[model samples]
Target: MAEKIIKGIVIDRFNFRDFDLIVSLATNFGVIKMVARGVRRPTSKNIYILNPGCLGEFEIFLARYSNKLSKLKKGECFFNLDLNDKKIYAFWKLVSQITRETNFVPKIFPILEQSFAKINSKNADAIKVYTIINWIKFNGWIANLTRCRVCKTNQRLINFNFYGGMECVYHQNPKPFFRFGRKELEIFYWSSSNLNTFLEKVDFDYIYLVFEILKQFLKQNSYIFL
Candidate 1:
């Protein structure tokens, strides 16, 4: 097969015997793993561009099968997020780990770029919550929170059913559900529509609530969490 030039974000890396390493990157094609021979050596030129969370153009010798690792011929960095910021660094790492390996997710790149930009702007909490919600939304796990899934009523939704989706007080059933207070529902609705605005004014409690809900949902459905 012909060599392909692709741009991607280096999300994770694993050291191999001696001076080699395996690097995983997120590209338009999906998550790709490539072998970087001798990159662990002190004098290796590829080390700089292979840093985790670095976005760059790369020359990849594509593998015949998606599960097999490809050969990385060369790479040039566009940008590398400062890994010194422990919070943001950890957040991106988790995002990379939770994302599916071989599947295509069209919205992943924009959401990741926006997330990095938001962290660079120092809006850490807001952007973290916003990014997670968008991830869930793009993955098709988010149900319409504004109306009841069954009755299609505009009444307040207070119960969350993994099997049946969001529900109202009058539509309760035997399925297990997560109950939310009125205040939490209001915040959920507001945040979904006006995430940027909510970020500007969100308090710690609001951020905590949003994360709790999202974490549980993700863990239940995708078996991944922050």
Candidate 2:
């Protein structure tokens, strides 16, 4: 067997037999689970590089069996997210979970890499919203927010639909499971229009609420969520 070098970010890790670790790495090739033999030991050289949020180039040994995960030999970290911060860690955990659960969609790794680069304290929440929006769009779940899917009118756009059309929640004829008001409507408008303006103007409270709902919707669609 020959050593193969690959570059990726460590999305997650689980301890194996007290001394080893199984790492989920998001790479250009897609997410792959590899065994980091003896990484749980304090003296292991790959310990820091094989943990979550670490972006590194790894040398691995390909498994002889397709069902078995490859072996993580050694690696060097190029960037590392500060997992010590609970909020930031939670955000990243959601991202990794999405990668783990969602089917292999083309170009998602690049989007994830771009998303990680955009996150910071100053614009973390905004970036998170933006990233989720992209994920929703990429997975073909985002519906038209500019107008009513049935009536084809932008007026009274209050209800949410996960299947591609949104109805009004205020009307008595039919009730919608996920609905939004004028404020949320405005947020969705900017989300569809200008991204920069959306990030700059989105209210924290509304963004948080919308984020939660969107995440739930993703979960309902068999995607990943926090």
Candidate 3:
């Protein structure tokens, strides 16, 4: 079998057997699952490289079978992101949401890589994270968060249709849906603006609210939350 080295993020992991693991990784090529032999052993060198959120450089042996399961031959940590407890939880929440919303591995590996780098950065704010997510959605790749689909206005006082898109106050009715106040809209706009400005001045509270809104939105769409 030909050996290959690849850079990837540990999106998920599960025990395969006594001392072995099956890990789901989002790599530059695509999402792939690999078996790591003896990874659970106390003295295993690969144990440190198998953690979720860790960026790794891995040596893998591709199998001949059509199922595409690879064997992890070796791995090394590229960067062990130093996230505090609160940040760690936030990171996990974002990852969970992303994995659920997306079916296939994204073609934009740079975006995913940048997200990981931002989440790991010491200077990253909660609002920055929120904005990044919104940016992705607005780009038409994830979800819609732009003008009201009905009213066609960019006003902040908006209602989110359960199906998708936003609605302005003019189109608002007694329909069962989620609404965003002016403040939330301001936060959303600020977060989704250019990356540099967002990173410079984003609030934790504002970002937290956006996160909750996104969670609810995803829930309404029947996405799994972890």
List model 2 lDDT by residue over 63-139, tens digit each. 76657799887898887877677766766866676667355554466655655665666666666676666666667
- Model 3 residue 164 CA deviation (Å) reads 5.4
Between 1 and 3, whose TM-score is larger? 1
**How many clashing pairs per prediction, in order?**
0, 0, 1
Best by lDDT: 1
lDDT of 3 at 57: 85
* Residue range 85-145, candidate 1, lDDT tens digits: 8766667656676555733375767666656545653566556666766566666755655
> Could you tell which candidate, 1 or 2, scores higher by lDDT?
1
Query: By how many angstroms RMSD does model 1 differ from the true structure?
Result: 4.0
Q: Candidate 3: lDDT over CA atoms?
A: 0.63
- Per-residue accuracy of model 3 over 1-226 as CA lDDT, tens digit each: 6688988888788998899999887776667688999989999878889888778788998667638778999988776555555665566556545543254335434555655566643444463355345534643634345666665678754655545455677866566455666655555555445545655655545666766766665555535352
Q: Which stretches of candidate 2 lie over 4 Å from their true place?
A: 1-3, 17-19, 101-106, 143-162, 165-205, 223-225
- For model 2 the TM-score comes to 0.68
Sliding window of 10 residues with minimal summed lDDT for model 1: 186-195
Candidate 2 at 191: error in angstroms? 5.7
Cα distance off (Å), candidate 1, residue 212: 2.1
